[model samples]
Target: MKNLIRTFALVTALLLPVAAAHATVLTETGLAESKVAASETYRLNVPTEKAVATTQVRLVIPAGVAVTRFQVMPGFTRTVETNADGLVTEVTWRGRIAPMEYARFFFQARNPEQAGTLSWKVYQTYADGSVVAWDDTDPDNTPASKTTVK
Candidate 1:
């Protein structure tokens, strides 16, 4: 009985990380219009799970889209960097989000003229200096949170 119990505990420990790897990104408001050339505003909420304090968050905007405006929630500092074509390439937020806490970010942008799906890639840094990336470039790798523009 003791050996069986030990084996069960080992299996549970191994599975914990896999279960915790899934992260969630949610929109505050309901779904937005998925039409091309449509103007949409998104309020994104990102929650931290295993990290004690989330120190930084980075988001990459999809090509062909224009980020007209963006704002970080109060208590955090934000910086926006644009590409040579004047489109927002990346948005970085520096703040503290305690474990189980969430950070809010808002942005308004126009969808690309073409109809398709846009993947927003995100990377997060913890107080311990570890990093978690939400890169969906390769489907086999971590899947990125997506927005569809039909």
Candidate 2:
């Protein structure tokens, strides 16, 4: 009985962090300033340097929400990627986002669990084949924003 109890406790402790990662948002500076509006339409915008024709963008969505709609600004192409389950893994919002330029996407997020915090990570692929990963931490050493969503 003692061993079983100890094993259960150890397992629970190990799983707690993994569970929290699902809810915790890691916002890294992708290329510019970004923000999330709590309105019915969850809006996101990332302003960063332009990507070469061969560049790829890796935009990750927060675990708690679903991306109902996604669009990219004109002058560039875009693609949406999904997991085998058909769930969106990442939306490759492409196009040469002009240096000091901004790109945006919209989504309809449902918070049935009434979760508090919403977050995700984003990575950028440059035209030269370089990669920039932003999981909500400042990659370029920029400050990240967090909020208490009601």
Candidate 3:
């Protein structure tokens, strides 16, 4: 009985972190439809469920898309890095988000002239140094956000 109890406790301890991490929800809002048009400016708002500081977010833009402007809302310091193609590759924000509080990051981009769905992958890093990858090709694996161009 002692061994069984000990084993159960050990298993629970090892899985606690994994369970807590997934409990942290990262969701985006304000963008309607999975479709967008060329040269259109879209806003993406990411909200966090837990109190966190020093949140790093990376947004991968599709080829031919250009990020014209980007900004993080007040109360937070932000730094943006772009690729040679003039697309914003990553955006990092440092600040404190109270439990259930949200941070908004805005950006303007010129979409590709061609009409197709753009898969935007987002990677998030929490204050605890835990990284959650929102990039998954499979829908069952936290698939990337998608927007289709008309």
What residue pairs are clashing in model 1? 34-150
Model 3 residue runs over 4 Å out of place are 1-37, 51-54
Q: Which 10-residue span in candidate 3 carries the lowest summed lDDT? A: 19-28
Candidate 1 TM-score over all chains jointly:
0.77
Expressed as tens digits, the lDDT of each residue in 1-150 for candidate 1 is 999999999999998766545333433464633679977776655678664888898888888778898754788899889877777899889989899777778888888999888877888888999877877655455567777788
Q: Per-candidate TM vs. native?
A: 0.77, 0.55, 0.66
Please, what is the whole-model Cα lDDT of each candidate in the order they appear? 0.76, 0.51, 0.60
What does candidate 3's lDDT look like per residue over 3-100, in tens digits?
99999999999986544432111213444333344455555445554466436666666676677876547777777777765567666666666546
Identify the leading candidate in terms of lDDT.
1
Give candidate 2's error at residue 106 in angstroms.
Answer: 2.7
Reference-based lDDT, residue 22, model 1: 35
57 Cα displacement, candidate 2 (Å): 2.7
> What global local distance difference test value does model 1 have?
0.76
Best by TM-score: 1
Error of 3 at 16 (Å): 24
**Ranking under TM-score, best-scoring first?**
1, 3, 2
